[model samples]
Target: MARNEFRKSQGVVPFGVGATVDFENESLMSAGLDVWPSEKAEGAAWLKIMEATQIADGRLARRLSSDLKRKIEFFLSPTEAPELTGFQPQQQPGRVFMPFVRFPNWYFCPRCRILKRIAWNTQSSPNAAELKCSNMGRRVEGKGDPCGSLKISRRPTMSPVRFVVACENGHISDFPWSRWAHQNSDKDCDGGENGSLYLYSTPSAGLAGVVVGCVKCNSNRSMAGAFQKDVLHRIFPSGCPGERPWLGPKGVEECRDKIPQTIQRGASNAYFAKVVSSILIPPYSAQIQQILDRPDIWAEIESLPTVDGSVEPFLRIKAKNLGVDPTLSFKQYESVAPTARWMQKAMSCRRKYVIAMMSTRHMEVLGRQSLSVTISIRREFPSRTIRIGSDNSSRG
Candidate 1:
């Protein structure tokens, strides 16, 4: 029976998609409370498992089933949908193609209120023919266009699509989002604000490669893919995480340090990954193992350390290699985009002191030391401001 339940549970998931993430995990991980809230913090501590996984590795959300997606979106509907009751207008898009690899923001519209997925693509051709909605479309009254709009009501969307593997044939097997939408899309949905509807949305190349087919075929294809993944993990040079050997932050960096840290070989990524992992994730393994634990993830982190947190304006500005000419002064930016684009890190401050979120760009030179390239991150995201409390320099 459990086997049947497992199969049923797996039926609705979408394959080749980024894992769903839970904010709750971030909170728990941040505090070093690794045990699942309900379980007693027992034998094998969660910290050990985390360190084993490399504290730097991102904790991806467990793969979700398509049915789970629907349940999640349904719960998110209320604030997203503005028009609660109606003869029911605004038909949903069937097989909607989101242009962006991963959309940053997505939600049901509050004004018109329907499950709407935003497709941000500069490549959308205005001259290209409009793709008609698969279901009934809205028709024109005295409208100039001959093809009238059909009021098909709703189109099945990914928010509720079951997470299931695609068979080689390209059909969605097990549970189907299409059939489910036909029955439930019309129900009263009162989830939440559209902005909050989908926070875990990540961009990927898989959806762009999607090929439609029958469900039975998709199931077969998915199983084959899963089998292949297992094979690769087993036969590859590195075995699944084990005691035989180690290649984590300390070990990987130790090996890399021997090669000598340099941007030339890209060995520095391992080091940076370690930094990102430490700051972003909880000190899972480090604390548990009590081995080489650096509590202040950014102990080495420097943000133009200020003598006073509340310094009014001019405190002691030590400018180094800052090519700012005496004639040039602060020119208010016309558009924030340019600022954000020119530099990757932005400037944020604690008080009057301006802190630059700049990283050193190690440029290798033949005989001399690696040149440091200072980039302006503020130029990358111009919309952001000092209030963001971040420096704008970023070294690519």
Candidate 2:
């Protein structure tokens, strides 16, 4: 039951994918329509038909070949279906086995501060007056006429229990009522089974004033430190029993994490869903495609040195093949050139970018632009000599 609550809190609701509801804690039920239209057989025969048709459909097949240019794919055959029995088949595609089911009919009595699970009868008309407090017997002194017992309305009167117990290891269950009231001292009480338990709140409007008690043993305790970090562990000492009531009786496992109390279902900290996501990047690029189409021109450009002597010839060849401007002189290229040290720094940065892009499994690009660039030199040509006799006509 607690496991189901945890699953519901994790957004696995009824009629949705991954919903498995156990009715009356007797039979495990899943919510999905049977895909096959016949009821001839119940076991392997139904599964074989489902595996051949719905499960082996192209939409459910594995992607085998991907076209880099178009991002299209030729899908392969679906994985071999495992042999299983007693599976509730769904006729439609995308049916999932839900981990838990919803318990929406449960209600709480605000006056008495108790939770009650209400069962609905499909044959009878729904009555709001039928939902009543189980503590009606306590209202009478002895055993008077039970007719005067108060009826607790489902809404605005009876509410769901607002708090539950959860541990650090992701195990959650209903708050331990008997343990809290008995305080680990009464081994003979058998929790609260031997007596009736009552929850009451004082006028202070705080958890410190709310109290839970057993009528038979007369043991009571306040909820003051229930939410305190590691306080429950100190009180109980046994730690969390790893109770997952949603998974049924065998759900209990070994867990030693500290158990802390949490608020109702809708509370922010009640459930924390873990999610993962990634960005999809296209493998093909127009610039890369153009470069690949003319490998000879790319090879010529790659072979050129980063010196001024190579600039003019490289530009002429680039202009003829790659449509770069041949008229642009060496001075133009020199104006944008950096120092040798700066060139080394830029190379280091580019290398890091390349390594990062290659190492990632998803192959995410750094940005929307190409990192390729032509290296430039900033220094003046050493071959050009400075004449001391410059402007002789002006001197004359």
Candidate 3:
């Protein structure tokens, strides 16, 4: 295991979460470069680290003074041309908090069941952050403490974990975020078609970093989004979404004029009788005959010609809610039309279902799995439904 990693009593590291920082040496005066063997060199010259007087203090000091320090400071100051983040004392340790995460179900993976038992915050170290393991994943070699899905590399010293995501068409990619976010380097390999994978770049052993790949459409996105929300809570941006709606509740404007109005005429009117048989609503969305005796705002609606074709409902959703009385202005009321013909249809069908397909790589439910759920009785299947599912990724 890496000397710098934190481990728990169970001997595991919190794997597959966003706790890692994009740490680079970013040093103005490299201490180890001068000590490295001669074979390693950059360009046509050996790596040269400007020499400085090295000092040691038994206690960590908030400030220091030295000839070497002054020269380095001249170039490394915050305002300097090559300014760098000041050196931090490596001896000081970070607080080792207990950690746990929740993941999705992986019933489809039999041989990889124990992969879930892979290492976690099992031990603490100052030099390394990982433990060497024998866990060769199904697709990748190195195993995560909880069974890894890391992409593999052949080089041992450069032991980077590649996160390869495969699309349905078999276009597999190492989801390297630095390459993706910065759009620099490795132009030779495009993410390929149907780029649905998300990339998380993190520090590894040496030279290179590890990349954790995930699909945007994985059942675990919500779970992962939740886990990430807390992990990067301080750094997360606004408008962030939870497991479901990132936009939160539907607003009144969103429901514009979708709620139905009372009958324009009295409930006993002939026109009311003609349309009475055509109305279908769940008990929650409907009421008794007397309730309709008085006009709702929608009941006052004077012949605004119904838009032709499929756009009739667009008026309710885009502009206003269903009328409360026939006289109500088209712009007056707003709502998610629970009583619309389509909404009614959506609420009633037994065989009907809704799914949120993934953004990348084609995936489907296991053919053998069956799910049945009862919801408010509706008239027709909703034209839209969101997929609500999850997978085997750690959550906390």
TM-score of each model, in listed order: 0.17, 0.41, 0.17
**Which lDDT tens digits does candidate 3 get at residues 12-106?**
11111111111121000100112212122222121111111111121111122231132111110000011112423221121112122111101
Kindly report which residue stretches of model 1 are placed more than 4 angstroms away from their true locations once superposed.
1-153, 160-227, 230-396
lDDT of 1 by residue, 168-247 (tens): 11111112222222222343333322211211221334432221122222211121122222222222223222110111
lDDT of 2 by residue, 1-396 (tens): 112212312221221211223332212212112211222323344333333322111221122112122221111111122222343233433222232222233444545554344432211112344344555534212333232263433322344454566655545566666677888455457536432566776676688778877666777888886766666775547777775443343556887655444434334444332211122232333333344336574455446675446756775665556654455433334432333223344444542211000000010011112111111111122334322112211000
Off by over 4 Å in 3: 1-172, 175-326, 329-339, 355-396
TM match of model 2 to true structure: 0.41
Rank list by lDDT: 2, 3, 1
Error of 1 at 173 (Å): 21
- Give the TM-score comparing model 1 with the true structure, all chains together: 0.17
Q: Residue 383 of candidate 3: its Cα lDDT?
A: 39
Question: Of models 1 and 3, which has the larger lDDT?
Answer: 3
| Weakest 10 consecutive residues of candidate 2 by summed lDDT | 355-364
Clashes of 3: 78
Q: What are the lDDT figures for the candidates, one per model?
A: 0.19, 0.38, 0.21
